[model samples]
Target chain A: MNTKILRVNMERLTAEFEELPDAYRSLGGRGLTSAIVAAEVPPECHPLGPRNKLVLAPGIVTGTSAPSSGRLSVGGKSPLTGGIKESNVGSRFAQTLARLGIRAIIVEGQFKEGYKLLAVGKAGAELVDASQWIGQGLYASFERLEEAFRDRVDICGAGVVAEMSARNSGLAFNDLEGRSTRYAGRGGLGAVMASRGLKFIVLDGDGAPGVEVEDKEVFDRGRRKLAEGLKAHDVTKPGGALASYGTNVLINVMNEAGGLPHRNFSSGQDPRAEEVSGERKAELIQKRGGVRPHACHPGCIIQCSEVWTREDGADPMGVLEYESVWALGPNCGIYDLDTIGELNRACNDLGLDTIETGNTLAVVMEGGLLEFGDGAGALRLLEEVRRGTPTGRLLMHGAAFAGTALGVTRVPVVKGQAMPAYDPRAVKGIGIAYATSPMGADHTAGYSIAPEILGVGGKVDPLDPDKGALLRGLQRATAFIDSAGYCLFTAFAVLDFPEALEGMVETVGGVLGTPLTVDDVDAIGKKILDAERTFNAAAGFTQTDDRLPEFMHLETLPPHGHVFDVPAEELDAVLRDG
Target chain B: MMEAPSVTVRLFARLREAAGTSEIALQAQDIRGLLDALVAKAPSVGSELLEADGQLRQAVTVMVNGRNIEFLGGLDTPLRGGDTVAVFPVVAGG
Candidate 1:
């Protein structure tokens, strides 16, 4: 298969196609983005300056019927985390770009004085002047881009928050059904795009340039078997638990395991827990006019997306995921699911990271700005962000920054990125992931839930930090699997059935016309990590940069009454001598 | 009212569906005795929750009041007045 790179110079409104070199054909998605960012962009450059470049690449299995292979990676120097940041978003955009025979799109340099939207399809590329799209929310920008692209296209765009240079801004994308449900929401890459004066990206495939694959029979057989296996598994199958409840399935279980982050990591237990539980959310969806869990991208067998609506059945928003729900629901002390749904919708509309925004709001509330569980106050705070009020500007700067503005020190952040739902003091395995991952404070980066909480692979004690070495190994494996574009949930099957990984690599090699062994898979993963680590090192992140928040070690969590006992020296060993 | 010496041990999922309710009344003091009584009352749930050696199945988690038995006193965790013994089939997915 031949890989093509679409290079767009926003300043001159010029575009060109560059074919993939022999050495780079085997690389795409995380592999391609990390490599390009490492090789071309200077590590010490300002993340949002003209010196930085935003590299967008789809996963290796994207455009193919490989279960959940539609994840797209947006990689650049991060304005938020200040490290090698590659955030994944699942939308029709990745599949559309793959169908256009494009492996990656390297967006370089800032545009001339005004805003513009970059549209790419199989027909070629163009930089359309979009001064009209300035100050628009994500939904409005998407609608305008759709109108300009003749109403049918995949779009990857930023919101007004991004244009305003909010530290928590995100790149929003449409789900399979065209709601803005998918988010390339981590590491503040949207800030990088906004800095380039690129407001939005519209992808239309009026023309088709399907990627080539050798040995059609082998590829077809592999695809059929993989989809069948997805159907067979309860997790990704039709009408499965994930379909019924979305990722909120972890709500009750994680809470039961005493790992749910509640009241800004003050406790693992919530008094009004049932109000936000997955079972309750499922029931609420049935009552409200909302869609149950569905795929974010087409041809995805693992449909774990859900739509949430107001109580009166009006303006149903996108998926209410685990992280967002926890961030908006328990962490902020808001128990009403409708309030959570509205907050989630507001974040998507504003194109802000829900995790970071929710965390920032919680930090402010904890500082006595508002009473805990004040849903009304939360709404008002979000409105302030919309109007770009002074308080709003502080909130937009993210959790750590907001905490500093409030003169509070209990802020939970890793390398400038706010922590997600799980408290590190409770779920130590994922804590290790948050402390060690190149992407700051991202649970999905490593996802220690399978063993630490859910006991899927093997029971790893949640309170024990003895498995630090094992957690790092799993993180490496997970990074490779993610780069390959396979859904992380596939690990459940891959762990039980080794043939699953073999099948995936074989199918990837079959499609790309390159032979890939399991060992090669490991090496590819190591290379991705090396590129990220090298970039972070040059960007001035050191061993001390990886340490968890100071409050985690001092404050003892409730129920278990345990503090983060993993010695900083031991945490340092995660990347040390490796 | 009458001299009824028994207790109801609750099982969830398939075990409960077979036992006909979340809880079952059985007369047993120890874990082994509880299984024997459960098998005497509802044979199907007994087979699902226990192995031939009378040990609990690894796939099933037997908890008393949200605490895993293994983490607590194991089978020796003594039952008391109104003790809620719950059995849950392991359900792991996405």
Candidate 2:
């Protein structure tokens, strides 16, 4: 099946279908998103202006019968970072779009008059009036869409925060239960979508053409190999670490390592971390009769997601992950999982990025706007965001902006984006990743925690500063994995099992009708990273933008008593070609 | 005879569930001795943390006082009273 690209010009209110460009035929997921943004978008253009474009693409094997490959990449010039950004999410929407033979959808230009929703179906695409959803939160808006568009269709949209043009907003997608919980929640891409007058996007995938595999034999063999490896591995297997407790399992481990950032990076470990840990969360879910070992997308064997419910087990919230737990739980000094879950649900509804919102809330606490560990106060602040109050708007600009506004000099940010759970001062390799990532302090950019804390690939001392080479290798490998549309969690199996790694690459090659070797995967990763770095450089990012917060260098984290002492020269050498 | 050094053995994730507690006080002088005591205390944890040869499992990470054994003296890392020994199985997420 030939791939097609959808170009929607909101200024003209026109939707055009074109053949996939030859230059971009091989690119998919992050590779495709970054390549299009780098080539088409001007580096110095205003991120929320008509010049910026939002490009959405699925992986090469996303729609195929490959396990855990249904991730989507949304890229644009970030209003928050003023650089190239690709935010990723796992949802059935990616598979639906890919099955409709759409390789990428580039939304450009601006419609200042009113809001519109882009609807894509088997026949073609069209723009519809979305005025009613302009200022609505995602939960209410998605419920209305599910009723209007029929529950069988997939949906993605910006929330009320985006409607307010908040820089910390993100794009939300539907989970398996048709709830808008999954998000491409970083880089303020939702503001870009809102700026283009696109409130939501609906996909009518019923009776759509499925992905066509060129070599069924090769695809099946590769799929089988990967499936076997995923089942055999201790961490990725059925009833394994992820399946048993979900991603929150890391809370205890990170706390024990003295790497779980608590109270706005002032400390690394909290005595109450176990209250929000994966094990505790799982126990609560099991006792409350909630679902565990849930899959985020169809054909996902890992089943790391879970349906968390309230105390009485009546209301089913969304899936909970480690990052959300850390950012909203311990980072804010709140140890209760219920409060974190409520905060996470609020962020999902308001179309805000939970990580950024959590960081922002921590900054507000540091500024004495609210007391730390106040779950009720945090919930009230989230309500303010929904209401679009002045203080809420200020907080919605992300932690860096909030920190600057509140005169909090101990802000933990790199390149304007808030750092995630792991304190760089404690986990030094991830610190290097947070500092040097092209996406601005993104944990997923490199994820050195795999080796540094988890011992998934190989054990590395979390406090060691001699990890520039290790971090660089992990970042390159992660780029390739993200491009392939596989869940990052799958790396736990593929890194250790050689057959699984070969199987992932071979499956992509089989789908694209091209031969791909292990070496070629590395090459693709390097090429993608080079494109991103070049784009950031053109956007005026200097070496200074690639350093951690000043406090990280001066303040020593407790337990380990280590500061971020990684040399500047070593950091500069991380992404340098061998 | 000298009194055995007391170390705090901390378990995380599935290991904690297997051990039925987050931490336990054990009397041991080295990392291996602590593991032996841990196995005696919680036999179910031994299967996941150690091999039949009494060596640390490749997937298990053993850290003493917040320092990984690989950076210290491996399984022979000396233990002292009140030292915190954290044992975790291979786990990861983003």
Candidate 3:
């Protein structure tokens, strides 16, 4: 099998394809990304400097009809973490890139130009002038790309917020039929892209050759069985719970379990919780003509992406899921879905991580920037990024920096990455994940919602710390799964049916022409984790770096009323191998 | 007075939805005895709640309050007066 790499130099505006090393042939997703970044990019270079390279990789299962195996990983020196950072998104990019026989794309150096976009396809690469599109929102940029490229291509673009060089900016991707629905949306990576003078990336897969697989028959059967498993499960079946309500389905359950973060991680339960819940969201979408939950990718069965609409239904905002809604909705105390939807639209247009933006806004409100639940004020704050005002620059830097500028002591971040909606104090397992994960407090790293909230894989109490070791096991398993190019939602089926593992390994072996056991799968995951840890340690990270905010230890969440009692010493046990 | 036969029944998550009540009162002496009594008394709820082992199935959490009786007490948490048992199906959301 011939593996190819595309290396683009921004300073010289040059590009080349290099042969993959024999060792990297088996690597996929995070394995490929972490390894490449650790090897090629210097650990101590300024993250936004020309020395840093952004690596985009597809998983091993990419290009196959595997269920939910379309996540693409983007790795670099995180502007947020200052450590090895890899963020993945469930977009068509990975599947498309894999089908085009592209395993990884390495973007290096910086373009001297202030604004530009890169267009890639089977034909090759081009530096497109983006002057006309400067300050364009994601939706507008997507619309323009669709108009220009037609249905022949997919586009990855950042919003005007990135052009302004805001820290919270994220790179957004066009979903199926060209909606700005998916995002490489975390850790201020968009700012890095903007700093490199990259405004957008358009991938045209038209006429591209498909991926090569050794055993098509075994691939077909294995993939089919895995698809059947997802179809059989309630959470993963088409029009399943995720499709019906997006990820906001967690609102009710998390509230009942007392893990929902309200008013900036200060409490667990919000009396206004229902106002932002999945059921309520479903009802609101129905009333507003924006209710349909569509898939982000063309072949995705679990359609958890939604096209949020204005209350008047005059214009369609980008998709808003659990993290966005919570970040813009309850985390900042805004209950009106339309208002939250507007903020979501604004962030997408400006290319910002809604979670960080929402959390940062709440922190600003806590510092008396605005009253909590000020929906209009929040809207105005986002408008600043759109306008590229001075305050807009400060607001766009995200929560950690914004908190520092505001002199606020209650910044909720780990390794500079903002916390997702789940309060760590209430959900202790995820807390351990947040504290120990090299990527910072990202639940997607080791989502404990399964055991804590969903009752999958033997229920564990959300408030208990006794299951730290078990939680770490799940996290390690999840890391492997993510790297394999399987969608994290696939865990819903796998957790219930252990046979799914055999099916996945069989499929992998068939496609790669290599016999791989489930043990190999476990080893691949460990290798990825070890590589990331090595990068972080080399970049000056240590066990002391993995810790939750001090307030979590002292403050208690109400309504069940508990604090994170897990000692730092015990929390560190997650990194120790048995 | 005639003696009454009894067995403990557990509830957990969302099983409380079907059981009408958290803990139900049974007058049977064994696992089979309690299930038969449960099916006979709350026939509308029994088939949905109990499995063939007389144990609750997937999506069902049958715990005797603080303890998952499945691990501790089984369907026999040794019932006594005022022991509020709970039954629930696995919640659909989250």
lDDT of 3: 0.75
- TM-score of each prediction: 0.91, 0.98, 0.89
Candidate number of the best TM-score? 2
lDDT per residue for candidate 2 within A150-208, as digits (tens), equals 98789999988887888998999998898889999999999999999999999999998
* Order of the predicted models by TM-score, top scorer first: 2, 1, 3
Per-residue lDDT value at A477 in model 3 = 79
DockQ of each: 0.23, 0.72, 0.18
Alpha carbon lDDT of residue A380, candidate 3? 94
Q: How would you encode candidate 3's per-residue C-alpha lDDT over A1-578 as one tens digit per residue?
A: 43888787788777677888888998788888899999998999888888888888888888777777888888888887889888888788788888878888888889876767677788777787787887666777788787887674777776777666666777788777677768888877777777787777888888878777778777777787788877877677876667877778677556655677878787787758767777677777778887577876666777777777777776877577888888898888888777888888877777888889999898888878888899999999888778878878778888888888988877889888889988877778888888888888788888787776566666776767876677677777778887778878877777787677677777777778887776776567667787888899999998888998888888877765688888878877776674
Mind giving the per-residue lDDT tens digits that candidate 3 earns over B26-69? 76543434556766866767666666675666655543333344
lDDT (CA) for every model shown? 0.77, 0.89, 0.75
Give candidate 1 regions above 4 Å deviation: A215-218, A576-578, B1-94
Interface C-alpha RMSD, model 1: 3.6
Model 2, runs deviating above 4 Å: none
The candidate that wins on lDDT is: 2
Instruction: Give the lowest summed-lDDT range of ten residues in model 2 chain A.
Output: A132-141
* TM-score (chain B only), all candidates: 0.76, 0.94, 0.56
RMSD of 3: 4.6
Better of 2 and 3 by DockQ: 2
